[model samples]
Target: MGHGTENGVGRRAVLRGGLAASGALLVPATVAAPALALSGRPTATSGVQSGDVTATGGLVWVRSDRPARMVVETSATGSFRNARRWTGPLVGPDTDFTGVTRLHGLPPGEQIHYRVLLADPHDPRRTGEPVTGTFRTTPQSRRSGVRFVWSGDLAGQGWGINPDIGGYRIFDAMGALDPDFFLCSGDNIYADGPIAATQALPDGSAYRNVTTVEKSKVAETLAEFRGNFRYNLLDGNLRRFNAQVPSIIQWDDHEVRNNWYPGEVIAASDPRYTEKSVDVLATRARRAFSEYFPVSTLRPASDGRVNRVLRQGPLLDVFVLDMRTYRNANSPDDQAHDPQGILGREQLEWLKRELARSRAVWKVIAADMPIGLVVPDTTEGLPNIEAVAQGDPGAPLGRELQIAELLRFVKHRRITGTVWLTADVHHTSAQHYQPSRAAFTDFEPFWEFVSGPLNAGAFPASALDGTFGPERVFVKAPTASNVSPAEGYQFFGEVDIDGHSGDLTVRLREQDGSVLFTKVLRPGLVGQ
Candidate 1:
């Protein structure tokens, strides 16, 4: 009863499961080298495209623009003399012409460079240029200093300019800082259709997906997910950034469907198509996610397949939560129940045990939604309460209840050196919730930082300020000018952990390397 590769196919067996069902329509195999285009033909995309690198190995990603087997090389230099290599056919449409070669057996702490070659007939040169990246092995537990990036919600649906601007800016800033790994909060794409459609941004101002009115559900399918990922990979800045740093990614509502909770459909928000089941949609999204992402599956029978967690050094341990898949979105009886739970019984118990055994300096829970924000109405000046779209009286209440449960659990456990990172609510901010009781007195304080929309939506300062401004009790002093209503920027967060004192320094950084805000917290900061 061992496990299999991504498609759940045994490494020793010859059969394929999952997306392998669509193998009939895949690209036909060709010779190893690149074929020549006519005199004026454009160059096909090229290089040693790699992803999800860890201390031991990385998933080397590449594809042939034309049908051909690919030869991938990994080295510590541009020339790659003593490089480790992998060869395989760029198979089926399942990978969208891409091949994910698992590069194994390399020395740790060494900077590695890599490239891909299509040795076929047309053009015998490397498909993509020699792309270089650096990776370090997971450090020993006693090691103290470590740096990493946390971000999510890059689902810019309409008006492409926002994501383009934000993506470029974040990469520009990240290139300079060069953290060890990148963490996503969630909602990476606004793929609004079912399990087989494509997501396209319109020409004008609308940023939300037009799914409320669209007929086809194909946009949210595996094809669309793959397409969205391909589009994301196609971004020069995103690709360049990926080429340089290994990423730890998690999905949010937009990555599947908006506000998608377990046992629900997109139409669940409206009463019109309540009977429609989204189980198939979820399956497809999961399939696409596994094909494109490097996440480890925690479930026993995740649609009959399993995934494992990715680890780095002693400085960081990420328990990436698949919050959208297994938990109930709203309370079973009442949507606005005072203590509506989110992590559900199973995950809540699992998390408690995981936290209890962690030895890393930073144990980051990469949640897709904020566990700290009082969603409904903590204070009135917030846009959600004041501008409730008229009849939405229970607006913020639902979110408030969810946060209460998470805080209660953390307080009860007296959890220390723990931080919750989330997305969903587009604006990024750090909130510290203080417990009101003695059972949780020792761990009465916790910090929740939401980093998102890497290149997705723009945060309206007026909106965020209204929400977080008035209810400022026990709030840490602002590190930069309070984001004003008229001027604000799309941004991401960088977290650097100081192992010496168990202090975590959080920085709210704009895409262009400017610091929007900064804050530092400690395990002892709470209950003081």
Candidate 2:
């Protein structure tokens, strides 16, 4: 089968079988746009992105409208007159025509410009218009400062691509910040939330979604799951933001369904996916996620989980946790001794070892869900199960035990400058967890900053569990659902690390580019 040719196979078959012909080939520079235009296939519709940046390299991503041989040219200048060329993986039907190029040997702490060129996969003689992007590699010196933004929840609760309003304009606002990278905390897509072309607004106005056949229903098949990732790219603002700002992306429950776990079965109440197993759905979702995001962390480990660490220079180390992959089913009766608590044994051990071994001045835990927040899973007509916690006001219980153990380990290891950043709560808050205020005081004090719902419903603040000693320092939440970004509650967090002093500054900002709260902590003053 030729690349871009859709054989009569179903979506799942295409996903599984299309990778058989992924042979890497070089393209000639003589390839021109006119020749590709004759093929009548759309080129790069989703725009281009660069991500997973390290001191010496980064990953560049692009999605072609058809199967194509991907090429990336990098230069220090915006003009690619003397650029270095690199070949990306073959983009075929297996990955929904999306591919990532690993750009290595880049100069650290310097702005690097790149252009993505797609040629005919079979011919390699016809080319499409090149998409341009720029990113800076991590600084090799610990004396260089670092800045990045973090947020989550895209197209959730029926808030999807609105072409009329320029599709997720918050991204444009975030882009203006000019951060080095974006840490997508979780809920990158809502495969469970089907979007209609037109939705009725509260004031009798109509909100329009740039809908496709794939996004009109809950995602089940591989193609539908891939469509969930494609749906956001329809937004020009998101595309523009992605081009300039690299991303460190992760996923939470909504990537498959709200609060779904490994063994849960789809219920009949959800007409779109009745009687389906969530694990099967997650398999499809995970593949689509890995295909779309540029992060190598999406590649599963030997144990089939996506938990890893990213250390940028000696200033900061990010421990990205995979809370969804190894979690037990949500239930109120989850016990402290349960082996299937959120992080799983293997991942938790890896995290501890990574943290203790790190020499960076700052250790930021990129948690998909907050430690103390009460996340209730009311799916499948089941009683409200504690997805991450049981909301107990006393000692650690259930999943809390796992978190407590991790915290105690950190304390015992004397891992200073350790902080937590999370997003699943749909609000922005600054939380201070002090041992003196906790029922269990074995752990050292730390700060947890919560911000999210890049384009989704605004929710009220979740109640904190007393087990971990979380005290809300500052909170910005909405009382209603489906709140538009225009209302200005949509949030993203920013972190800036000073190289010379090793001071970290955290800022929570609103969708309108206004700062809601700011805090600066020096190296030795973490718990204070």
For 344-450, candidate 2 gives per-residue lDDT tens digits of 88888899999999998899999998888887766655665545666777887778888888999999988898989999878899999999889989998999999
Candidates' lDDT values, in order? 0.50, 0.79
Clashes of each: 36, 0
Error of 1 at 272 (Å): 12
Give the poorly placed runs of model 2, Cα more than 4 Å off. Answer: 1-42, 299-305
What's each prediction's TM-score?
Answer: 0.70, 0.90
Top TM-score: which candidate number?
2
